[model samples]
Target: MKPIKNVCVVGLGTLGTQIAIQAAAYGYNVDAYDPKPDAFATMQTKVKAAMQMTRKGPTFPMALWDAHAAKVRLHSSLAAALLTADLVVEVVPEDVESKRKVFAELDRLAPIDALLATNSSSIPISRIESVTTRPEKCLNIHFYQPAVGMNMADIMGGSKTSPETLQAARVFVRSLGCVPLMVQKETLGFCFNSIWRAVKRQSLYMWDGGFVDFRDIDRAWMTFTGMTYGPFFLMDLVGLDIIYAIENIYFESSQDPRDAPPASLKQKIARGELGVKAGIGFYKYPDPECTREGFLLGA
Candidate 1:
């Protein structure tokens, strides 16, 4: 309800850190809380690598990113971080209960009028909103990897989300230099994420069914789209463990056997193959095969 000048980000994981950085880049005062001791340090290392590897894309320059990344305040306690927040975004894991716990805590700590949002890629705020008293003030402000040039956000509301809240959120997204993709109706996966989910599902199905090699699939996608990375490569960046969790969410929602995650994927996660963070997933990090010039040509 206020001007949304100060933003509090709970859970400084991958996207959490990026959101904080993007907000700060636009001159918004940002405070974040994460139990992980090295969350801020890890975010710096991860974002620096991402900027270096990404030769193109993302409108902001390196200096801007550096300047803001340095200013994002990371705090040990959620209460301290939420003290002056006009907006509080929960970026915890994808699980519903985890989100509910965070949302309840955020509701208790954040200012009465401060907007509470979830960066959950799939789970709607509706499912998680009731935990807090102000359902009208709670909404889903899902973000893609903004640091990588996917500079757009899905702005979806719960059953009780107010129109004023929605407009303010759109303005907030724009303030961060991102397009607000307002979802007209409630959906499991918001806008581009739903489409991406389909691609991911089919890609995994084909790979798991032994119908085609994953590498060949990536090549096909890269060649067709003329993009730097393909589905598998992008999935690796999204993290294999995260992909598995998202897939399981779909499977649980539909109760469809075909939607279930493959056993091999589980095995990979069990071995700590979490993608770029773990240094090995679909491919090794620091120099994934997909980043090589010869990848498209099958070299």
Candidate 2:
């Protein structure tokens, strides 16, 4: 429960990198690790770019970059990163087996007293804890996308997760200026994803029913909800592959037809038309000079 000084973020993907950056910004010594050399290199470059921008005044992307570059140490080796870490956060992929493998290795590498956490959105904390010896310290610390900006976080406890462990996680999340919602019972998808699944089901139903097109559905939702973007638009930004993966998880775990993604989504995934990152999805981004309309089909 004491203040976490040295933090290790295992998995330097999009979410892990963001979490490490946030921890560094809060003055915590952060060591970010990933197996891939290229990923580590990318994070190091990104952190340096962010720091340079921070030194400069607010200038569009530079301001944004500086905001991200505050406190991060990039590492390629798990052993090296965890040697000095008081807390270890596993932000690997959502697959249960993959998470178990990471947790097992972390258990072997990290200090005995080091608090271990997972950034998994849907996988149950109990399942993850079952793989590690330190079940009392293993828990879920789900951060929303743009973890640095999202103030809301979900802290889920397995059956063996100690109360002190939960308290420590709450304190750590608060230190980062984020609100931690304590979940006593760990469930698949937890709170956010459970709500999101419902919303996704309803949206897909409407789309499949021929009641609306993608654009109309997006416009209606944005106009009524005051959100920056509609569900489809957000999905596009999140990548169609990820959306498919999450939906597949939900469907497999719950056996709920509602959680099943539509055929159109399946087709998109099959075609490798992943969203913004890949330049095409429900919409497209032909080039930097292209207009939004140009990204739409038959515009």
Candidate 3:
């Protein structure tokens, strides 16, 4: 209802931290919360890395990075973070019950008029809105990782979500200089996510089915698309564990065997091969071959 001057970001993981930084970079007062105190310690370092990476993409007002970074306020408690927030963005794990629990808590703790949103990749907002009394103000404001490079987000509403809420969300997304892809009705994976999901599914199948070597597939894809990363490299960036979880969600919803995550991914998880964070996944991190310059040109 009120101008969204203050934003509360719950969860300080990869995407969560970036959202908070991006909001702050745009001069919004950001209150970031995470249950783990240790996460708070790394905020500065992570923010620096994200800024460095985003600079490689689009041209922006680079001077604002420092001024905006100063606007972020960290807290360990949800109530403290939501105290002055006009909107709250939840970026927790993609588990249904976990999201419901966070939504319930947010509804109870945040200001009555503060709109609640989730950054979930696949789970629809309606499934989360049922746990709160303010369903009309709850929606999905899904953001792509490395929020700076992909300056677009999926904005979807639950069945009971109000039109006013949706417009307010659009306004909020625009405030961060990000485009909002509106979904008129509830949908899994929103827009780009649905397309990406298909690519991820096919990529996993190709690797697991022994149809082609992963590196060759990536090489051919880069040569064709002239992109920096292929499906496997993107998977590594998105995190293998997260990919597995997203696949499981699709499988559970459709009960289609084809949607089930590949057994190889599960094995990777068992061995703690998360992704760049663990320094190993589809490719070694910090210096993944696909990320090298001239990769698409056969470097």
Candidate 4:
């Protein structure tokens, strides 16, 4: 098996920075690329905020994040980023067309032998691999925010993804001190994310239908799960804009009206209430209601 030494992450948005930092912390040469000039800096702030909110997610000290992060070389162009990459993780917008464009660029620029993967939360790699020449080398290697201590990766192979490519990705994920949750077959929102998606969907429906206040739902979740946050809180961390987009993908796929994301959720996005990144969403950030005393105790 060819060991992966260099990791390149495309689109340093919500998940990219954490992924990059984790790879670098584990001794991999990491590079990141994002079209937005200030994307990396913005992501850094979000990560720091996440690190503060989390205790068990981050594997290293907050002080060490900068050192590990500094190890990543940021590039202005995709070609430069993929030049030395052995594995490329694409974290672009979760739309199929948007992903197609990125995979095409990645296929054209990345070294022929390098493996290409997408960190898309819901869409599977099968919808993307056709855009690349090396379909066998393409797979879905999804990650949650590892920088905050969720150190598991969802690993799934596309229709044509080779056994070798899938095996190599498993090795790479393990090297980062992560549990690689293998998907035996193609599935949207693979593994834990699929479970998370179900929670998000039901939560949004209830809120939109006026069945219950979002906070009450969150309180119940935290109360039962013993987690620091609930479904709505986690969605904010994922970004409301991203949540809306992923929901749309589900609606478009199933053509089920019931599967549609709530209209109010779209309004929130339209108003720029894009969760933690925007400082507001289901709750205000850095000091959301979920964190207040007596929130879970129903005060």
Candidate 5:
């Protein structure tokens, strides 16, 4: 396995920021890229808030927060970000054309030895690899949001991805103190996400079909699974817009009417009730019921 020192993260959104912060906190030099100047303007503040939130879990050293934050360099261009990267984790928007465009650029500008990975939750690495010359080096490295707390990433490869690349990715993830959940074959949504998609699909169905209240669904889930949050809560945390897009990917993959995202979800998106970011979704946030242990546990 190659010794990874410099990690390049392409995107500055939620998952991207988490990945970038975790990499830096682990002493790796991280270069992050985003097209928006506004995104860059508040990068430090976002990182600080993320770090503070994650610090609750004692995930990263608080004493090193500033130093680690400093290790991350934000770039406006892909070429600049990929310059010295040993591993490139692309967390760009989850669209086929968008991901393909980033891969094409990465394949052209990044070092030949740099391993390429995507933080995509739904799209398979094979689809994205078609745009790159180095299919063997491209793989998926999907991370749960608040990655530092989760400490898990799903590593999968395309049809052409070599065993060597998979192992290298596993080593890289381990180096960051995160567990690597390997996808044995090319599977949509990898491992945990596949299961998560089911829960989300059903939750949306229940809510849209008028079968159950979203809060009740979460209550049953938390009580049965012993998890702090349920599908609706997770969907809100992930943002309804993102959830809709992922559902669309699943729908496109299966073409099953059941896999189709609920129309209510689209309506929510239209109204700007995009979950926690919008301060309203399945539940009101900034103080969602799911966040309260007493509410979740019925205490």
Candidate 6:
């Protein structure tokens, strides 16, 4: 509430690292933490890359670098990170049980008034809130991948999330140069994932029915909608395993058949064909050439 001088990012994965770097760039003293010590090095590398990227833009603010180096600190211990945190954002993997464990620990370790937020893509804020004693301060601050590039964010409130807490989160997110849309009620997939699942269902149906190949599907969206990447490409960028996990959670939470990830995806996941990160998915990416394999069906 007091302008969030010091913040803690609880998980230093891809999303968490981006969020922490962005916050630091905004002049907030940041304490970044992960259970793994190797994560510290990974996060630092990411921050350096992000800083270089920002420097290339004409509109980039130079003040961010000075504040970032002076204000941000990385830690491997949860206690060390949460000790002086005024706001704590949890970006752990999208497992409800895992989130519950993190939230329980945060509630115990962080200050009582610290604004606790989750960056979950699909998991409900209500479920996360249930694990914490101070549910009134628990909320969701969903940021898209590459948080520095994406300006849109969602501020989702659980049943127990207080108005004051929501307002604080909105202000904080805005300070990071992001647009925050407040979701009045908490839902299983929130806004983005729900809409994404619907789109994915249709795409998977086409793929499974042999109606279209991956290239055609991607081209259709890019050509017509003017999107930077098509569904398949975006899925690959997001990591096939992560996409599968979200769909599985959506199916479990809503019991909706449409939310179920198709057999093709399950089979690929089972075979360890996890997309760009894993070097294979809808399309193959050879090491030297990076050539695409699938052809456009209707082109």
Best by lDDT: 4
Q: Which ten-residue region of model 3 has the weakest summed lDDT?
A: 50-59
In candidate 3, clashing pairs total: 0
Q: Which structure is stronger by lDDT: 5 or 6?
A: 5
Alpha-carbon TM-score of each model against the true structure: 0.97, 0.84, 0.92, 0.97, 0.92, 0.85
lDDT of 4 by residue, 177-283 (tens): 88999999987788888888899999999999999999999989988988888889888888999999898888888999998999999999999999988989888
| Candidate 2, residue 245: lDDT | 77
Question: Candidate 2 — worst ten consecutive residues by lDDT sum?
Answer: 51-60
Candidate 1 residue spans exceeding 4 A from truth: none
lDDT values of the candidates? 0.88, 0.72, 0.82, 0.88, 0.82, 0.75
lDDT over C-alpha atoms for residue 55 of model 4: 34
Q: What is the lDDT of candidate 2?
A: 0.72
Any residue pairs clashing in model 1, and if so which?
A: none
Candidates ranked, most accurate by TM-score first: 1, 4, 3, 5, 6, 2
Residue 45 in model 1: lDDT? 85
For candidate 4, list the clashing residue pairs, or say none: 57-148, 57-149, 58-149
For residues 68-134, write the lDDT of model 5, one tens digit per residue: 6667898878799899988999988889899999899999999898999999989899998989999
- Relative to the true structure, candidate 2 reaches a TM of 0.84
* 105-220 per-residue lDDT for model 3 (tens digits): 99999999999999998899999999999999999999886443767889999989999999999998887888888998677789889988998899899999999978877888
Task: Single out the weakest 10-residue window by summed lDDT for candidate 1.
Answer: 50-59
Off by over 4 Å in 3: 40-67, 297-299
Indicate the worst ten consecutive residues by lDDT in candidate 4.
50-59
TM-score of 4: 0.97
Which portions of model 6 show Cα errors greater than 4 Å? 43-71, 285-299
Model 2 clash tally? 1
- CA shift at 175, candidate 2, in angstroms? 1.5
For model 4, the local distance difference test gives: 0.88
Tens digits of per-residue lDDT for model 6, 99-164 = 999999999999887889999888878887887889889998988754335555688898888899
